[model samples]
Target: MRLLPVGTTLFVVLTLGACSPSAPEVPVGADGRTDPVLVQGRDLYQANCVQCHGSGGGGGRGPQLNGGTVAASYPDTAAQIELVTNGKGAMPAFGGRLEPAEIEAVVRYTREVLAENG
Candidate 1:
């Protein structure tokens, strides 16, 4: 006879489900920037963040972002913007490549995506 624990099965199922590729955030707010920001953020993240941060915003070669890393490292959104714009240790600055608006959009996307996953 085979015995399967309930909790173990549930954990296995959840782990499998979470392993799938993350879809972009849809059904954004009325403002194009708000929701579209997440969609655009997904693109920006795929292009930039994925190299370091995991596709799901989890830690990779760098550090985990879904936690308070940004909030702790940067005082506020502006600080995060500054870091992303200016770059930090090992991380390259993206200011020239992306416009301020695009940066904000990607920031919003990161936060939203983190929230959804967390």
Candidate 2:
């Protein structure tokens, strides 16, 4: 019998661990039906914002957006729209990349879903 190298063994273990089954899915809303707006928002956030804000908007390369942080910063929906559209500080401007409606949807998702979750 031949022994596997340490690096190869570690890689195999890690790969197998990653292939393990994921946790069960939970209903998104009280009635077990997710809101369309939230669904849209979630999709948009995942596509455009997840890289910086994290999967749950808990923050990563970007500032924390959960737990009323967004609400406190941008009290008005319009203000939130501006921030997300125009961007600020280290954040990149998305105004040109996304349409107005898309921006609104993402903001709604951030405020309604992400904030509420926190």
RMSD of each: 6.6, 5.5
Worst 10 residues of 1 by lDDT: 23-32
lDDT of 2 by residue, 36-101 (tens): 766777778888887888776788899888888999998899998998889899998889998988
Which sections of candidate 2 miss by over 4 Å?
Answer: 1-33
> Model 1, residue 54: what's the lDDT?
74
Give Cα-based local distance difference scores for all models.
0.73, 0.79
Clash pairs for candidate 2? none
User: Quick one: RMSD of model 1?
Assistant: 6.6
lDDT of 2: 0.79
Q: What TM-scores do the predictions have?
A: 0.67, 0.71
Which candidate wins on lDDT? 2
